[model samples]
Target: MVTVNEAKQKIIANTEVLTSMSMKPSESLNYVLFQDVRASISLPSFRQSSMDGYAVHDSDITARGTVLEILAEAKAGEGTMQVLPPGAAMRIFTGAPVPEGATAVIMQERTTRTGSFVTIEDFPVTPGRNIRSIGQQIMKGSIALPQNILLTAGAIGFLSGLNVEEVSVYRKPKIGLLVTGDELVQNGSSIRHGQVYESNSLMLRAALQQEGVTDVEVLYAKDDLRATIDALDELAGRNDIVLASGGISVGDYDFVGEALQSIRAETIFYKVRQKPGKPLLFARRKQTLFFALPGNPASSLVCYYEYVLPAIRKMSGRSDYFLRSVSMPIERGYSFDGERDEFLKATANQDVVIPLDGQESFALRSFAIANAIIYLTVNQNKVEAGDHVEVHLLPA
Candidate 1:
């Protein structure tokens, strides 16, 4: 068995960022940019009016109540390249291009209009007032967004404004999940004696979806070694990552480890010195990564959050892939002397964290309400009421 740190390092050393693909910026939300995105053209490529007012030169408005003749009207999206005659004003609306020699746009509310003329009010009109200058937002041929930034909705709109059609971004990975155990029965089915409703598949699928991974393939396998081997082989052949829940521990019915070996997959690590998920397994077959979690629902989920999720994040081009952990005081005293490290499901605030009851490997009630996982190291098991401890915050 390897230490938790060693296991994590091994996973990191083996994982690589996936290849980049060209996708439309609108469809690239949550995907990390593989390269810097440069602006194709300067935003607002022309002098634009920012208000529904008159476009005029500095001399057009010499004093309050100065009346100027309206040469022509310019609406949004219409050309206004014609020069404004001397001492004349052009009726302009928001987003309309400004005519040549026009230095300012007086808002309509601050002016009174007569027949074919507008009278400037007492409001001071300065040069370039209410005008959007060319390239006001972004300059042409400059880097609009840096590499490795996650694209949000606002970023997508910004890219569209810059006329960027497609972007190079790291693609999300395709995952394959294989659930094992014959004692487990599907939900909505008749439960016979000694049979329990299966929930790991749905739980794991929802977890994967939360990470923006939707292209998942799911399969079920019995305790038979051959069935397990076949299911794993099929999943590994079609996915970038393969996950198997159950049949990892050394038991008469456990066959996940044997099946992986039978397929000639390289075992990166067999177990970690941790409670609830000590029998976790990580391996690789060619380019596809594999993880076999314990059959217990809570242990399976804990392993997924700690190990599998990080691997997915790395593969999807995230640099900060590990869970966010911080040290905080415990709300109450707790004592445990187990040889393996323990991860207790807990709810945490900014000041302190409270470890919830029902932390057993199969319990899920506490995990359901947990927002954080309080990590207790193997050797340092005793914790005082106010002692600071490491807490890993779960993604909301």
Candidate 2:
């Protein structure tokens, strides 16, 4: 069995970023940019008003009570082609184009209007006040967003402000999930003796979706060699990553490892020296990567977070593929007698982490409330109450 870090390195070495595709900026959320995005046009292409006020030349405001003739009204989206004459002002709304020769905007609330003339009441009248100049945000033909930036809502909005409708980004990998076990039943179905409600698929799918992986296909396979083989065969050709749950351990019904061999997939590693998911299997065939996770809900989810999520992030061209880790004090002491490294589910804040109960492979109740996973190395089995520990923070 390989160490967790070694297994992670192997998985990363085998994974490659997928091809890039041109998609609308709105549809490119969470995707990494393949190329630098340049602004087609300058943001605020023209001098714009930033408030509901009167646009005027600074020279026209001689004093606080200076009165100027109102030329015309300029509202948002309407062009004001006429230039402002000396001692003149234009009634302008927010986002309206500032007229030529205008130096400042006196907010309407600071002025009193009588007929075609308005008196400025504010004491200070500064030039360029309440105005957004051309290219203030982004200059035309300039790089608006650098390559490899993950497109978030703010990035999309900024790109949109630059008049960019589409962006070139690395495509997310297509994933196929095969859940194997005859004792597993779907939620809402009647359960008989020896039957368990299948939740790994649902949990894994939700986790994948949180990473912006939506092109996922899930299929069920009974605890039979032929059935598992068929499922693997079908998904291997159709997906870039195939994740199967259960049937990899040395049990009578465990056939996932055998099925991979039957299909001639190369096993990168069959197990990791970690608790809860010691029987994890990772393999590959050509461009397709495979992971056979333990069947227990907590074990499956833990393996997915530790291994599969990073692989997906790498394939999507992310620079930071692993979960955020930090060192914090443990609220209480804990002990493990085994040699394998353990990931204990815990609730954590900025200062400390509290290891929760129910650390068994099949237990997920504690995992549901856990915000972090405390990592305990095999070299040390016991921890003091206030000892500092490394914690992997779960995605919110």
Candidate 3:
């Protein structure tokens, strides 16, 4: 078969982004924008007060003890405020519009007020200090958010302040899952002499859910070849993607590889150069993508991040969807040799890297809480404590 890179390219080349509705601005929290967003109106459309203070022209306040008469009182949400004449001041609360000819603001805390007249306690209170200018936060006719920007609490607040009600964003993908193995038993059930609890499927399902996938249909099939193929064929038509655990290895009950072969499916690659996921399978037909991950939990997670996420992104109309990792200073490093590129489980304490107990792909216990991977590139195998490496971030 082909290399991992070749398989990924094949999958990318064969798929297309289906047209889907984007989330509205009111509901865009935690979603990615599909396109740039432009402001319909300038933020802070009118000059406003930043604090409870007196609006006065800077030229009018020359020295300490200088006094001015309040022309009008302004409050929050009050209607059209009249402009103040030269040397005149207005009583303004927070968020109140600054009247015309007002060049600066004298905070109420700094001014000694008596009736309508107020005395300035501090001189040289600059203009624009207490006044928020028009479009100070955002400009009119300018892009508010760029394409592929992930919406957050701050983004929501910004959009809300701009009076945005709707926004365009990508939707998450829907996936179907299947687990085939007679050696597997459901949780809380008594296991037969040779059977074990079915853990891989649940682990994979949880991973998908963490990726924002909500529409998931899970199925469990026996080792029968016909039964397995029939189940896959039915799921293929119903879901945009399929994830099959087990039945892809070289054993007699491993019918997934043969079933795909029977249907003339395009098997991108049946093996990886990695340890636990060496027997991984990838195939696709029309728009329905399928990934036959190893029954091992750690291996399944590796392949999921490596391959499954890309498929979900493509189906969701996201262009730059891929796994991301952060780098930190390695606390310890070694020069080692290995055939396949290794992704070791690691814990990061700020800039220090600590390898998890088990780095093998079959060690789910060690991999479960892993947040980052220690990327050891192929071929050469040696690193120092300060080496910068690549890692695949696991779901928290």
Model 2 RMSD, rounded to 1 decimal = 1.8
Note the clash tally of each candidate: 0, 0, 5
How do the residues 205-309 of candidate 2 rate in per-residue lDDT, one tens digit apiece?
Answer: 999999999999999998889999999999998999999999889999999999999999999998999998999999999999999999988899889999999
| lDDT digits (tens) for residues 171-213 of candidate 1 | 8889999999999999899999999999998999998888888
Q: Any residue pairs clashing in model 2, and if so which?
A: none
CA lDDT scores, all candidates in order:
0.91, 0.92, 0.79
Which pairs, if any, clash in model 3? 24-167, 25-166, 25-167, 335-382, 336-381
Higher-scoring candidate on TM-score, 1 or 2: 2
Top candidate when judged by lDDT against the true structure: 2
Overall local distance difference test of candidate 2: 0.92
RMSD of each candidate? Answer: 2.9, 1.8, 2.8
Report how far off residue 56 is in candidate 1 (Å).
Answer: 4.0
Candidate 1: residue 160 Cα off by (Å): 2.2
Q: Flag clash pairs in model 1.
A: none
Clashes of 3: 5
The C-alpha TM-scores of every prediction are 0.88, 0.95, 0.88
Rate residue 109 of model 3 by lDDT.
93
